[model samples]
Target: MTAYESLGAAVRFSNVSVHYPESATPALTDVNLEIDEGELVLVIGRTGSGKSTLLGTINGHVPHFTGGRLSGRVEVMGRDIATHRPRDLADVVGVVGQDPLAGFVTDTVEEELAYGMEQLALPPATMRKRVEETLDLLGIADLRAAPLRDLSGGQQQRVAIGSVLTTHPRLLVLDEPTSALDPTGAEEVLATLTRLVHDLGVTVVIAEHRLERVVQYADRLVEVADGRVRHGSPAEILADSAIAPPIIELGRYAGWSPLPVTIRDARRAAAPLRRELAGAFPTVAEVAPPPDAPASPAPGVTARGLRVDHGRVRAVADVDLAVAAGSVTALMGRNGAGKSSLLWALHGTGARTSGRVHLADGTDPASLKPPQRRSRVGLVPQSATDLLYLDSVGAECDQADQESGQPPGTCSALLADLAPGIPHQRHPRDLSEGQKLALVLAVQLTARPEVVLLDEPTRGLDYPAKDRLAATLRRLARDGHTVVVSTHDVEFVAIVADEVIVMAEGEIVAHGPSADVIASSPAFAPQVAKVLAPVRLLTVDQVRAALPRNAI
Candidate 1:
């Protein structure tokens, strides 16, 4: 029998504290926690709040892989992490990082899934059986022969999870596992994870920003804030926590005795609020153009007969759309539904088989050079770090200012505006996923481009950070800049998007205002919309505005 079988808990931490080099603050401080076997723990925190640091301690990556000072004891599967390296704990621990591509070891989906089993020297018959089972479990069987690089971001995330599952480890540690997936795809992965914990008795720990998607499935909630950790049941912790999902926020706003964490509970409790809001129509704040804009503004972007092909697959097909000059449009769809491809084609990057894309001035964006393209339209791709090559954040900001011909510290100022308090000297790779995205966003906005396109922009941001980003996009629209965001965050879309465009099978399936499209569709509806159905409320803020002063 293994050490974990003798011990009661799957993982234990006793007065754990981690300190990195050249950092005055400890990443984790005096953390005392224990995770029982077969428990599914959800970790929530703001951007750069050290959620990842706590997970790193599980598999000995804290001090073993990353050079740092680790104090106190961290035991995983009853083995002290201080003595065991990451590879030493491989049999009991399987980890998937925030960036899935970084962990991939092979070229194709099938090979990547079997790579871990091969490393463990499992028998050929067992490996083959496990590989097929994992592929089917994760809903990636059709992609067995597909190359890793060609798959969409969400597809890559599934393969990453499947790769570690084939090892049959006792503990699974995942960072933002559903960040890149669409709503349906996220459900499939989460359902599979829930099954693993219940049926196979796997211990799962996940750190995610989109709490609405994972909070309902959590057996316990762990909140990491400023190097401290707090743990309890999902309802118990979220009741008093500062960061909460839309569902919890709605429950609190409606004065429910106990805050609900799922749509069904909230819906059962929302009847009174819906009655109060009867006949009240939701009002969206209008964004007026800046004073410098022309009296009759041209369309921000216009496309016709756009198509993007990849080998035998048609990623985007004969799409036609127009975005207003001062508006925020959300491009939303399931994974591999052509959202990212359309954004790339619009920005004059990626492969475009045939299309006509024109800017406000009726200029073809694809005709411009790289530098010229930046001035007209800027793009922050799904992999935000791919845009950063410099060593330090300060150096990157300086370069962006120089290239954009903006004043020195221009990019730094934007960075502070988006995500404040990021260290200037820190390496881009060393920063959390959310921090890297902010840095890239600041760099791209330095040029003051006419049109901005961001793909999966909310992958690692917290609730407050998302609020700030929403305010920023609203400000951009008010200033006569065009903004387009392709994301799977339905709540975020409800907040920021003036227009919603749904794509499927490389075509525009639904096009209309945010409320009409999102509220009607069960798959894309936010928690508030789902809870207060028929009333058409999309966010907590909207619900607040519609209620009477005394009711609040």
Candidate 2:
């Protein structure tokens, strides 16, 4: 047995099966696994692959929340999950789910952070102390008085984590906690997790689709597919995993030994390979076609003097932005900056006061019906799952295509665009968070709208999902579809956005090319952008290209 096995099994499932009330098949089937104390393990799979179900099972949520029939034993900290209530497991196991907004029970950050502690009936003084400690631990002490809704997506998520941390549970489970955060916010959350695992000796289990960020940090890797654990590792498991991170995939394609796990490792592994294959190196300098001339109306989506009022607060006032038909526009802002509100306005769902908004190339700005909007703009809402309710992935795609009146085979075509040759019959929601995101994207693209608006597309996606989404957007822009994403993923914006718009207190503070805007606003920039600032490179590929052959 290992250190994990020796910790008396923080979680144990033996021949576990879960079947929903109306479902014919089991959501989870005959599964067995063990996670011990002080271990940091990563759980990964496409949506509906049982990742969330499995995580929920550890706390008795499987049968309780979904009216599911569960068979077999699920033991968490020596307690049977099925017999114990979710509230019972709260003391030993802390869960920070993907959606922060849904998890919050209190209006203010301080109260929200203290709620878990209060649930355990901790003394008021103790709860207060724990709340302050947790706030400091996550580095969000200043936002304690802030309303949960007033904070940015990233800030809200951090508070959620702080709430769970205040309980000091032995096992910390996070399901895509960093999904809604920008690069900087993501780093902050990850850093906090790292500290908890390293300094406090807490057992951490994180189910995420973004493998790159956590792969290097994870002590163990668990991969699930078809509602079963397919891969486990002490030795590296990247080569055998279908959803391996980009650097690992790149290494596998290049046939590097001991498959690299991190970008630095990939760099070192590729150094000699590049030199050895210099004479036969494939030309990678294929520049995209020159951008089309700025049209009479500027060939873009431009919002001038836009104003949006949020209750008594004027969230976004006098904002100006432009997104070209063949380019990406990134909306950058701190929490409560009205980024989502602006995206909603553009999607014809928000409060728009005085502004002249235009969709260049003859796109009608007045049409508000679903059909009318489908022809001019495709929207992947902030929560892509808000639109998904089908029984399976194939069904969801078909439904999207049918509703949008896109031709048959549209979903399969979009799948091919995301991951060539992947099966279409798989459950759409069963895919890993990243894969589910891809399906939502495919569904959106089926409309083939000239302009695409995504609100926080990268939220809750693992690194793999982020990279794939970024690549897909780049390709879409290259193909001349206007792409506008309102996001906190600064690295994503830095890599793909031709133009950047900064929204602060519901007003446009800055607008320019991505490079100039990112340079001027380092505080809101991506981690990589901040790290490589002054030198300036966006994507990882750019960083690789700019490096000297022998730099590694």
Candidate 3:
């Protein structure tokens, strides 16, 4: 029997258009779609492409909390969402938003898990049972008592899911849920969600960027573009639609039919091509980074036995870290693992930090004035727009140059080095996520501070943008500006960092060169390393070179 016949309609939208009160552009327009029970649909789109808005409509969040103008009809579980309040719809639909921090309500995992059931007025016994079941399903049972603030990013995200699932909703909608998770964490979450669909008959719908990871699991593929449902399908949808992964794009570019959906399928379809292309093997030439310029003999920044506290909680403790005259040190941990607090402590942002944080001339970071500290160190906040308050990209860079006392347009030129071909006159908000990230990187690099700290700089960028950012970072390191970045993207660390510091439970558990540390650790390891098991090959080129010449 068809899913529609078996479980009824979980979600249906016909000619749905959502327009915000103050916005000229509609968030979603003329969208028509239906999700049947026990069906898993993959919604693919770039950032700000209305995927979030469409997903939000399933539970009446679009017109309710957002106060958007809604046209057409939205029905979930055969109930009209327009007539129902979000709280009413919450009973049938569980949503995990892109920002996990936004969805959290309580302090501890146990409290958060119990929140939905409490809202629904469930009995204590029922709530307890549901919370435990959700925790076990998500594999976060060990963290039941942990504070929401103390959990890793992946763990925190899982907790967000657990909180939502406590309601026992028939429909689950996930928005970029695995964006910040490591491969293993992502795998675990996806596996759990998959089981929930197959075993419990929950309807699953997720919007994500890493399509290759979830495409294989989705029963239906939905493409959203220009604020409309451009296409849909089980077989022909993927075959005819434009929504697919990078490797699929590569295959399409090379004119491969029956495009591979997953890596295994890709491998099979590519075997013949590999045989034909073996003689013409593509060589990934090592782009020798510019020669290491001798750094001026000036102290950059140093942290000696540093410890940070959040009230009674210690986010970072007894961590000795350093950034020399010119280098990049990447700090990696799961979310809520003290990376952000450490970055703030290094800059002395009024956070409670102990031990010693020093700049040039052995000056204590905590003692330095704000202006003096800023001149010596630059911080690019997670949101580039947070640092940008200008009209145009060029103007923002110019402002950074003036504030830093550098030559006019110096920051703009730095941006050119980081991301060429970007128009300076364009509004910073109009740029792609990667270009925006590049703009911030350029602004920070222009200050030419002795030390620079980037927090999840590549959070929203695509693969190409990531590659460009990685290249620019290497150039920055080689040029002698000590760099520190905290991120969840292990693939990025594998490519750029000279040193990788792994933190867990507010303490530095592992620290060493990237290759060695990533090779040894399971939590912070890169995707390439996992694929080439036993060996610690971090980059694709490394794997390519390591493969025996005759392996193909």
Candidate 4:
């Protein structure tokens, strides 16, 4: 018999508290949570709020792998984590971390998927069958031979998930599994996971910031904040949650008791609100420059015949586009639609088979050196940690200040503004995913570049941090700094993007105002837009602004 087959609960935490070395506060404190067999539980919280720490304890990574002190009991499948290390529970518990690239052990997609099964001593035929099943399940069958390093961030995330799913563990712990996926891809993965829960009786626990996508599949919700956890049904926790998805926010704004967690629920509850807003048309005007600002601030970025080739694959193909000055532009598409390749080519870092990219001064970014290119166009890639190598957050900020020729602590101030409460002495790699992204963003902005590019910037950020980032991007536009963001977050686009550019198969398929484009497209539409259809309203803030003071 298997080691944990006799256990009643899939996971159990008994008054668990964790303290990391040299840290003033515990990562998790007085936390008591339990997950039963065949349950799909979602863990929700802000960035750096101990959601990851709680997930780590499931497989004994907390005090064992993380070198922290544990005061209470953590058991996975009734196996005591104090005695069972991560490897000891590997057969029954599988984990996919926030950064998929970091966890990869093989070079190719097929190899990675088979590696875990090999470790379990599964027969070759079984491994082959499971590998093919997982690849097709995650829709990465065509990328089976593709190198893990060359695949898009979303593709890597799928491969990572597939790698774990191939193991067929009784319990699965996923951290931001769908954070890198497009809307459709996310839907596919979540549907597959829900099937696993219903059909196979697998227990799944997920921690995600994009709750709009996964909340519908949750059997229960666990809220983690300040090292504390609150567990209940989705409606029970989100009814009064300060950090909520746009759909939940809309439900709460309409004062719907038992707030909706799904699009259908919100839409059903929004009929009256839709009637109230029937006559109102929401429009997002470009942020106007200050009166004292220069009349012709600067020319925005323009590219003609841009093409990026990766081996035999043509990632970006002859894309021609122009970004207007003092405007926030959002580039969006499916997993391998060349958004990252296009952004890198624009930033003068990625390969360009043939293209002409010109900045404000009619200068080609590709023609400039590294430092000059950074000053002209700054980029925060999908792997935000690639830019961080310093020992501590303070050290990284100081280096950015020195390299960018900015005054000391300039980057530090920006970091504080972007994500507050990040300890200066903490190592860059040790910080949470959102915290790392914030630090890299601060470093890039220290150069005061004319144009900024961010790829999936909201992957790890909570709603509050996204609000801060949106405000920062809007401020950049108002200051005549062109900002371009490649993301799958439709809600964020509705809030920050003045113009939306949709790419498909490496070509721009649709380009228009955010409301015009997203409202018309079913796949890209935000939750509020989906709920309050026929009104052209894209955000809860827009709905609130259009209504009377007490109407909401």
Candidate 5:
């Protein structure tokens, strides 16, 4: 009898190991695991961890699609993946990757949803019915006729998911699906997935970095780290791992019997602790800039009555802002709330109907030449690859050196500091998401511009990589550069940002110190603040420093 014929598991791996051609060690080493049918599993780990390698094994992509050496056996739905390629397993496994824009094959949403079903050679009537059903299920009926390129990041994500769901596969695999979405959109996507798991009996496997959004819905948690795999319940796995949500850390700090994964459970566990520290004020750090600190005769950059339009659409309207030298500012907002347009306007590149940007010399930025403007202001857009279009990594770095008027190895040195170990001879497209962002940022920094801007810099980075990025931004600020970033990662903002700017509907709603603004906003608050509030603490490290020895 076949193994899966007797057992109810959807996936099984036995003594599996994978080694890339250029790597020294296996990405996954001696791994044995089984995922039961109708179970929703979550995979968590640091970047370059074996999470992707493990996820790819179920569909035969690790050994078959990607040029890698595989050992041992993998079975999905009672079929050995070693003998069956991905196309043969299409009816059983459906995969969706990180970038939705790259995944879609058609220009319109409706056509993109139908393309997969057509490739499978489904009946025409069945394809039409399934396309409409998926559009309604994902709440994207309004965008059925909309062009895929024109939609916002969150909308594109919804369409991508719907396109894959139309196939009715028994096993679904998603890689960081909600990384591009806002809070509300992320919740919507998760709710849809939850329904699919419970009502349709489909098996779901997801690898995601934003644990806060997916942990509550997970039936089982699998962690890939240090060339091994660990599996347990959500609380059991997160109890010992450093990567956890704010609520989980709060439960650990209070010495609760079991870690809480949801806000409701956390509140129930913290009732006694809340009563114990009713009137206590947190030890505050000096985060806000002094009023007199930027008291010099000129500000680093100034924008007054800034207005941007896109063919009768006011993407940005009447925005005024300023930043002191040597400060790191974070721009945060919901999807489609004008954050990207504002950043582009400040860099003197996007559409500007009426606005004036002045540097310390009181010169309008719009009047400068392309070379002169780039040396003064540098921007890394959401599509970072747009800034990188060379034959190889070494070639790109060399070109950056020439454009910025820096020495021969200046860009190479900066890239090493940002993300070491990237092969110089490899193609830029072969690098991971985090590595790509680092390369672009290093190239921009080679110019030593007075101002630097990044849009969604944490899109696909893991926790360890984020820590390194935070440290680099801090160093840049100390070196007297005005750094600004547009992102939705509240945890990252807590660690790196000195100032916070909140935008809504093409206007600034609040601008102040990072600690105060983040603490006040419900949507923007970090994990630590959610649990330890009334105290206004932002990180677990701060809470540990403030608590007494016997508190735990």
Candidate 6:
């Protein structure tokens, strides 16, 4: 005889399918699923795999706001979504989109948290109590007075979660909830979500690309692909799913029975595999940088005593490094660790107190005109969509071609190479995050700068898109372009980076060859390294190459 006993399934979809009028293909096809109350579900899929489309239906955004052809029934908390628009269902469902910054309605952390409740017009005393509770629950009490824009990407993400959480909705839906967070921050958020599900009986559904951080906590896994929806226990879905974390991939590679989903589980079962490769300890020498590589080249990017500050805060302090031509350097660090600040400073953009960005060709990037600077050294910011505002994808490509002074179809050609078969007439806003990223990347690469800087380049990319991006970076490096990418994806760094640079509190703490540096830290190690530690392998392909023929 409580509120929990009254509700049936938190969300139920019966023969639901969606097709955008502008799109030739359906985003989702005949999906039928039910999420029971208090269950925690993880939605997994490749980019543009209809995961977003599925989540949108629960909160009444699919056909209501998106103007899509949605057929069938979607009921949340015993209320039909066909009749209840998002505003009407606000009390039962709360949604947090991928780009948290775009959804902000206030400047300060506390203000943003309270803004949602104010829309519902709750009593002042009730709103105050809920706001305080949400702030403490999300561990952002210290940031209440801080401006939302000034906070780190992770901080902004926390505020966004708290904002929706203040509503006390029965169901919470999130898209890429931890995409911007560091490893530690992501862990904290997941733990908080776990507590909410167990204690309050709140059902939660989340879509995430980094399955490594989320799968173990998932009560079930829901995969959307090829116009189908498959739901089952995490192990059953991941057993054959193409979209998976490094741990799952490792489990498959070694043929681990009942596949381990977490690091602890993998460790307990890795003993036999460990023994097989004992005394085969890979020498640091084997993975070390090429001996003939230049320590410092005149025609490369260099920084001397570089420092960046936002007001009185020293985001990056006195960092010195050299990026040689024809190599990719990955900047790895935790949230608010100054990786983004350093990348922006290096590219001669963002705020800087003191920094000397010396380009190889005897030019100071900061001193050049904005348009001239873009052609000489291009940058794709953390939120790539900020650079896109044209009416259609084709228009944006045309603008990039004109701006870069390249051939008319240059940008379009690059876009096709990066993301195939994207409708040129589609609005950039309607594209998935991965597709948007690919578009911006194509726009920048068309300029053909000698030095290219990308912040969180793999934020929303799927496995295949990541593979394609790796190949693109390799091609750029082969053409003698210096590529510096700041990212939290250790697996990606393993594949594309020649060097790894670890940052903390706005300074470079460790710098070495990619394989050597990644293998040294437990938190930064790729799944392959964690599984085959003694062998010093960095990727699955490396393990395949090292093992005997027909070993599997």
For 46-161, candidate 1 gives per-residue lDDT tens digits of 88788999999999999998989999999999899989999999998999989998888899999999999999999999999999999989989999999999999999999999
lDDT of prediction 3: 0.73
Q: How many collisions per candidate?
A: 0, 21, 2, 0, 0, 0
lDDT of 6 by residue, 1-552 (tens): 533257567888899889888777898999999899999999999888889889998999988998978898888887788998999889889999999899998989989988989988899999999989988887889889999999887788989999999988889999999888877778888998998899999999999988888899999999999668999999999999988887887778888889999777887787776655553434533643432333444446888889998887789989998888888899989888888888788778767788688888778788888888877788888889999999899999999999989999999999998888788998999898889999999999999988999988887888778889988988888778899999888888888888889999888999988878988787888877876666677776665555532554
> What's the lDDT for candidate 5?
0.82
RMSD for all candidates, in order, please.
2.5, 5.5, 5.6, 2.5, 3.1, 2.4
List residue ranges in candidate 3 displaced over 4 A: 1-7, 21-24, 139-152, 231-300, 309-317, 324-326, 335-337, 350-354, 380-448, 460-475, 494-499, 504-552
- List the candidate 5 regions with Cα displacement exceeding 4 Å: 1-6, 249-256, 271-299, 407-413, 548-552
Task: Compute the lDDT of residue 75 as modeled in candidate 2.
Answer: 85
How would you encode candidate 3's per-residue C-alpha lDDT over 283-343 as one tens digit per residue? 3112211134324535468788888888777888888866666666788776667888888
TM-score per model over all chains: 0.97, 0.77, 0.77, 0.96, 0.90, 0.94
| Candidate 2 lDDT over residue span 382-420, tens digit each | 656667787787787788789778788887677666654
Model 6 TM-score relative to the real fold: 0.94
State each model's CA lDDT, in order: 0.90, 0.72, 0.73, 0.89, 0.82, 0.85
Judging by lDDT against the true structure, name the best candidate: 1
TM-score of 5: 0.90
- What is the lDDT, from 0 to 100, of the residue 70 in candidate 5? 92
Q: Quick one: ranking by lDDT, best first?
A: 1, 4, 6, 5, 3, 2
Q: Is candidate 5 or candidate 6 better by lDDT?
A: 6
What's the true lDDT of residue 93 in model 4? Answer: 92
Please report, as a residue range, the 10-residue window in candidate 4 with the lowest summed lDDT: 284-293
The positional error of residue 323 in candidate 1, measured at the CA in angstroms, is 1.1
Could you tell me how far off, in angstroms, the CA of residue 522 lies in candidate 3 after the best superposition? 6.0
